[model samples]
Target chain A: MNIDAFAFDFQELNKEIKSSGQEELNIDNCMGQRYIGCGLSRGSLRIRGVPGNALGAYLNGADITVHGNAQDSVGDTMNEGKISIHGSCGDTPGYAMRGGKIFIRGNAGYRAGIHMKSYRDKCPVMVIGGSAGSFLGEYQAGGRIIVLGLGSDQPCPVGYFCGTGMHGGKIFLRCGQLPASLPDQVNAKLADDVDLQEIEEDIRQFCAEFDLDRETILDHPFHVLTPNTKNPYRQLYVHC
Target chain B: MQIDYFYPEYEVVRNKEKCTRCGLCVSQCSNHVHSYSEEHRRMITDDAKCVNCHRCVCVCPVGALKITGSNHQFKHNANWSRRTIMEIYSQAETGGVLLSSMGNPKDMPVYWDKILINASQVTNPSIDPLREPMETKVFLGSKPASIERDENGRIRNNLPPHIALDVPILFSAMSYGSISLNAHASLVHAAVDLGTCYNSGEGGLHDDFYRYSANTIIQVASGRFGVHKEYLEAGAAIEIKMGQGAKPGIGGHLPGNKIVGEISKTRMIPEGSDAISPAPHHDIYSIEDLRQLVYSLKEATGYKKPIIVKVAAVHNIASIASGIARSGADIIALDGFRGGTGAAPTRIRDNVGIPIELALASVDERLRQEGIRGNVSLIAGGSIRNSADVVKALALGADAVYIATGALVALGCHLCRGCHSGTCNWGIATQDPALVSRLDPEEGRRRLVNLVSAWTHEIKEMMGGMGINSIEALTGNRLMLRGVGLNAKELEVLGIMHAGE
Candidate 1:
């Protein structure tokens, strides 16, 4: 099913898409059509223009791709399937996603993977080719977030408070120096062979998806930020 | 050696003569407070470890055990109370924020006790529930101000989905992880049998319980745990939990130990990792943002389920509820300060938020003043004890009342307020295998059914005595209620005339 979403209402477009009985949907000129592919259990969506906030929210097992930039909350609480963005996305992208992978070619806004949790094999992965804003992976219980500094030469690839309240999961940032003065709960160290090996396949997949040299991306020093302890708060608050 | 800062609040007492030295208490005490002594061939108990859960006492074969308040005394002052002194000492010792469980146990003025219900007299004779047609049925959702007909003058059924309740009572939000799966199953079965609903708190709904989806109210809090397509679509209604009454401005942290097994799989978080729901939805900083979330859920569910916006009863509760009425929500749930929690900072639990009675009266009044009272149904929670409370809440302008602590009690919770430890012996609040197994869902469901059924009967009797046949007629009927000892301000806030008027 092909939809020209230039002047069509978002609700109407979604209604038509759901009733069209097609697994593959192509939407053109999709400017700020919010909640695209929302709660879609099946089907693959291809959007030509920028989608709005909460794109693919609670997407159970669908695949979505945007030729242009996407808005905030790209895949909020989405369970399964994949979302690939061609350009930059706004804040809280992939927030609290439990399953599937989100690949972005350009930068992402604040709270890229806040509260992202992973369980068993249903791990969620978010890879950003460019820089990211602050509060990256904040309160991240699980899942993997890899930010590759493919663009500008910033000292640190991400902004401040990176991986704050991170209990589980690993964050890979391509940078020379660590972000300054991390919280007492987290530790930032240069990636060793073992750390690099863990995310090697994901990094390769990211590079392969965005057309980048794997060897060149691997040669640069990468910094890993991890929580000092997963559950540091055990009966910390004791009332008399 | 670690220094003991405070003494045991209660000491377990055992009758040596009655104790048979069978070691049953040793096996029953999950806190490991009891140990069998080889030297004396008797049970040695630790007073400090006793949470007074009564697990041992309840399981004792010889009916010889009881917990007594310790006689330990301190050089106390009126202003500097014992608890205050210990609190200061504990803070000085560890510098930690105080954590506690359950609802506030402080002796604040209980407004429900202050307000009196009036019975019909000779002028209007009371109707007997046994003989007369009494109704406890309540439909919860937004009702149009008035019915509008179509072009042909035929009545149109354009109302949104509403929860049909045989009683005004519902089992409130106690998340799957916070309580055991068996407990959830019990609530599910009970709600189904009682023609009411139970909430899936913030924890995501387990796949096994989807059969009871019609009786569930899946919650979408700041954490959005276990939330997905099927979860949102499963429930009869969806509740957006903005704030809890116990800890108004606080988030939640389900510790790593409890986040194992099915809980981890259900919540989709790693095993043995802290699940922290932030204090506020970062995206929702204003009312417009709140409206967007409400509509987002509505769109997600295809508008098949009613959206309930739950907010804590605070100082500005009237204005907050007023704004919520216009937020496209079908129902507004007001949780007072006495609401329960698995774990909360003690200060907030004891000090934050107002009582539900005041909040409900004011919110109902405010929505009515704004002429949007029909836009949403009002539900009040926060320590609704019995049938009388439910009736009073309805008369005070609430369409229904939610009960959590009562439901837990029906499932064998002693309200030890140690739910945060995840070692509930009666099995209502714990995820531990043994403790959870102790609570048979079949038996738990029976007790729960009995509790709500009894409440329903009592509610009918109360309504019958008021000469009101149906709950819809009794709703917001403040004339049937009178203030007992309340002053001018309290009477005005409650919108009830003083008794003898």
Candidate 2:
């Protein structure tokens, strides 16, 4: 079923999509409609044009592909599913998301993948083709975030304050050098064969989705960032 | 070393004549305060190790054990008191922020005690609750202005969702990581039995408690821990936790040690990883951002559940609440500075935020002045001590009240203020398996039910005395309340008249 989404607001468009009784939907002319495919399961959506903030919030088990640029919080707290953005997206692309995969072909704004987590057999993954903004993976508890830095000229693909307050999970950046402003609580090292091998499939998947060569994306020296497990804030409080 | 060493605050006084030396206190105290010496043939008590939780006192078979405040005093000075000096010494020694549990134990005024309720005289007849129908039930949600009608002259049902409560009390948010799972079980069971609701704090709901979804209010905080699509759909309502009362501006940090076992699974984070809730939701910078979250939740839940926005009672709370009331929220839950927490910084808990009484009064007045009071229901919390406090809150404009410290008291908490230590003598706070096993969920549930039931009876009695048959009638009825010792400015802020006026 194809939805014009031209005459309807977010509420009406969502209502029509929910009651459309179709397994697959193609939303066209979607200009800044927020919360598209929110909390939806058991359906596939293809959206054209720009969607507003919280594009696929709390989305459970639905496949959403945005043909154009998306706004902030693209997959806020989404549980299970896959979201693919063909163009650049705004901040917090996968904020607090668990058990899903979000693929962005172009650059992402600040705080991308902040607080992304995972559970047993439900690891969340985000693959950004281009560079990412500052505070990437801030306070991330679980999951994997990969920044390919496909066309960036900077030595590092991520901005300042990368992995600030990160307690769990790993971030793979295809870069020559690590960010200088990395916090002491975070440990960054050059990725070895084992580390590169683990996320190779994810990089390949991102390359395949964006019609790029996997070998070219993996040619650069990669760096992995993980939180120091010594419990950074342990001695910060005393009983009163 | 002598300058740094301080005397214990409490001393255990054991009666030598009545003591049977059963060693019950030695086995009962989790803080290792009591130890029996084989050579001495008696139990030795360590006052410094004691938190004064009353566990040893209650468990002793003989009526021989009692704890008393030690007379060890510094040169009494108005400016530098013993507690004040001790806190300074503690911080100087450890160079760490002082952390405290439960509510503020400060010397601030509690306005609930100053406000008095009115009774009926010969002009108005007091209805007996037993003989007459006195309704304590309340429905919390946005109230529609007028009924819609169809073209055929029939009433159209366009009312929004509401949470029906048998009483005007709810079990406030206490996350699984903060409290034991059994504590959550007890609160949820009591809520189900009482026909009310329990809030699942920032920590996600456990899988076992999904059966109680009919009485659950799942919360979404800055961290979004354990929040998923199923969790949202499982709740009777959803609450967006903007801020907590104890530490108004600061965020919550459940130490890495407490994030173990079910907490790790429920929160969906790795074991031994810190569960940090940032102070602000990154996506929400303004009321428009709040509206986005509120609608996102509504869109996720299909607009079937009422969305509650819980905020701390801080300065500029009236305007903040006005903004929230217009942010498409169905309920506004205001938690005052005196509200309890599993753990919070001592300075932040004691000094931050304002009293719920004044905040509620001003927010209620502001909303009513703007003619948007019906847009959202108000639930006030922070130290609702007794039934009188509940009645006073309603008269001050709260649709209902939330009880956490009072509820934990019913669950056998002795207010030791040691929750941050993760060794609660009672099973209410700690996650230790042995300590957690001490509290039986059934027993806790019964005590909570008894507390709410007793409060409900007293509320009916108070409502009957006021000649108000329902809680709705008493809500915002400030004429029924009079200030006693409050000054003119305090009385004006409370929107109540002085006594005899």
TM-score each candidate. 0.95, 0.98
Computed on C-alphas against the true complex, the DockQ of each candidate is: 0.60, 0.73
In the range B128-246, model 2's lDDT, one tens digit per residue, is 99899999899999999889999999999988899999999999999998999889999999999999999999999999998898899999999999888889998999999999899
> Which sections of candidate 2 miss by over 4 Å?
none
Model 1: CAPRI class: medium
Q: TM-score of chain B, per candidate? A: 0.98, 0.99
Top model number, TM-score: 2
Output DockQ, candidate 1: 0.60
Give the clash count for each candidate: 2, 0
Query: Candidate 2 chain B: minimum summed lDDT over ten consecutive residues — where?
Result: B1-10
